[model samples]
Target: MLLLTLYIIGITAEAMTGALSAGRKQMDTFGVIIIACVTALGGGSVRDVLLGSYPLTWVAHPEYMVITSVAAVVTIAIAPVFRYLRKLFLMLDAVGLVTFAIIATQKTLDLGHGIIIASIMAVVTGVFGGVLRDILCNDVPLVFRKEIYGSIALMVALLYHSLTTLLHVPMDYAVIITLVAGVLVRIAAIGFKLDMPQFKYNSPEH
Candidate 1:
């Protein structure tokens, strides 16, 4: 139940961010809705496909799509106030990232996968939606440029795996601890402007 609740929140947060991206591009309503849905669901879809998990979440629960669409509309209505909610959005995104990672890790473990693949799928599930959003928005993918997004997902996966598998911690406790730790690490990365070193190269004239 906790995972289900967090899943809804994750998609709504992602959908709102997607709507904001579309608004920045001045897209029509349909474009905004499409981007929002894609941004909210694309990561999980990709993860499922790669893991051979049939019946994707949005497919099985069509209401998730409805929820994402509604979120997009609401975001459009409040577009004017988005600038003031930048930090709030960032924090929500942090929560969404950790939530997605935890859910993906659980799914992978349920499928009898080891921690390694679960960790990879966690990162994919947490970050690929934003990557698709950026690609559609014609911006550099934030995972590649912004503060430690994917790394936080990886950390969440590893921490969750260690707690549940190695330490024999209860699943609920593992989820709560991993979620809090992941969110704090991500927010700290944002607050401290922490990121992986950039690779910059100027090519010789072609």
Candidate 2:
């Protein structure tokens, strides 16, 4: 139940940030909502499809989509407020990243999958939604280039796995620890300007 609450918060926060991106591009209202929904839900949808996990689905639960769309519209009304809140939104995205990672880890483990699969799903859930949002906005995907981004997802997944599988910690405690630790790691990366050297290559023209 705690995890569920966190999931809702994560999606709402992500939707609002997504709306900011749409506003930057001056997209129409419908485009804002669409990008917001994709930013909020696309990661989980991709994870489910990849893992063949049904039942926990956006298609089945339209309510989540409705909530995200509403959040996006709300953001549009208050876009100016966020203009001075770049750091806040970045932190919110950090929260969303951890929430998505924890949820994906839980779902994969619940499906009787192994830790490795859980780790992959964690990355997919934590990163892909923003990737979709960036694609829609014609921006470079952050997961592919951002500082310590995907690394944080992997760290959260590992922490969750260690707590539940190795240390035998309770789920609630594990979730709380992972969430706090993951977000902090992300914020610290930003504060320190930590970034991977991005991949770069060019082939000779044929």
Each model's TM-score, in the order given? 0.94, 0.93
Off by over 4 Å in 1: 202-206
TM-score of 1: 0.94
71-165 per-residue lDDT for model 1 (tens digits): 99999988889889889888888888899999999899999999999999998998899888899889998676753778888999999999998
- Residue 175 displacement (Å), model 2: 0.7
Model 1's alpha-carbon lDDT is 0.90
Per-residue alpha-carbon lDDT of model 2 for 4-85, expressed as tens digits?
Answer: 8888888999999888889899999999999999999999999998998886567888899999999999998887788788
User: What is the C-alpha local distance difference test score of each model?
Assistant: 0.90, 0.88
Q: Per-prediction count of colliding residue pairs?
A: 0, 0
Model 2 per-residue lDDT at 193: 87
